[model samples]
Target: MKDLLLVLPRLARMIGSLLGDREVPLSAKVALGAVALYLASPIDLIPDFIPFVGYLDDLLLAAIVVDGLLNYVDRSLLLKYWPGGAASLDTAAAVARRLAGWVPSPIKARIFGGRRHTA
Candidate 1:
């Protein structure tokens, strides 16, 4: 958990970098922005004040977005903007994928806009 927390800033930086990159699909950009806004918004599927499950909804949503990015975004481009070791991002992506595994691949594809750049 501490390690995950430590990587949050790096993840934020990577997301910001990707957002500025023109190659990212419009769908991905919209999904990313919407998820970020949802995360920051006071309203949530589950309130954050609860003990253990308080953040479950946020975590699930983030995992879904991360899964979409990993599936549709270019691996090389993602690495380029990542602020940490590739292994770290790979591990995090893997974890997100697992957390979001229940979601269908078609949904993930739609979220990332089917890799519009296609490379």
Candidate 2:
């Protein structure tokens, strides 16, 4: 719980940094916008009516989006934007990849930034 608490702020900062970066690809920006829109709108792939599973769609989509966003984002850029240790960021990235492991590489490639960020 404590560790989870530590992640959110840094995560927000890193995401903000990524969004502001001119080098980040347009596709990633678009995808992030789409996700935000989807989450804000009342429409869900799985309606939010079911008991425990109602939010599964949101969770799954979030994971996929995170994966798409993180996978192509230059590691160096991530490190630069990160407020915490590299190991923590790497762990978070690994968790993201594992959560979206079933997604195909080809499709993932199409979803996010392609250009590597230069230090």
Candidate 3:
């Protein structure tokens, strides 16, 4: 859990960098934007008042978005903007994978166009 917490900031920085990079495709930017919007919005798939499960949904959605983004964007470009070391990036990816695992495949297909996106 501590390790996962540590990686979240690095993941945020990477997403920020990707959003600003001209090389990143508009589709990816839009997808990232949607994720951000979803996070900030009060209405969630699960209401925030629901305790642990509510926040779990948010984390799962974030992980899914991160994993999906990695599929469309080039790794080299992501590496360029990453402020943390390669190991940190790997750690973030690991966290994403673990969280994403909890999500059902049908939902993933709906979000990622029927393809299983892996980071």
lDDT of each: 0.84, 0.71, 0.76
Question: Which of 2 and 3 is ahead in lDDT?
Answer: 3
Candidates in order, TM-scores: namely 0.87, 0.79, 0.83
Tens digit per residue, CA lDDT, model 3, 1-119: 99887777778888898888888776667778988999999989999888898887788889888876655566778788888877877777777777788888676555656543222
lDDT score for residue 70 of model 3: 59
Per-residue alpha-carbon lDDT of model 1 for 4-105, expressed as tens digits? 777778888999999999987778889999999999999988889998799998998898998788777888888989988899998788788888987887
Find the 10 residues in a row with the least total lDDT in model 3.
Answer: 110-119
Candidate 2 stretches with Cα past 4 Å from truth are 1-6, 113-119
- Candidate with best TM-score: 1
Residue 114 displacement (Å), model 1: 4.4
Give per-model CA RMSD.
1.8, 2.6, 3.1
TM-score, ranked from best to worst: 1, 3, 2
- Stretches > 4 Å off in candidate 1: 114-119
Instruction: Give the higher-TM-score candidate: 2 or 3.
Output: 3
Residue 105, candidate 3: how far off, in angstroms? 5.1
Clashing pairs in 1: none
The deviation in Å at residue 61 for candidate 3 is: 0.7
lDDT of 3 at 12: 87
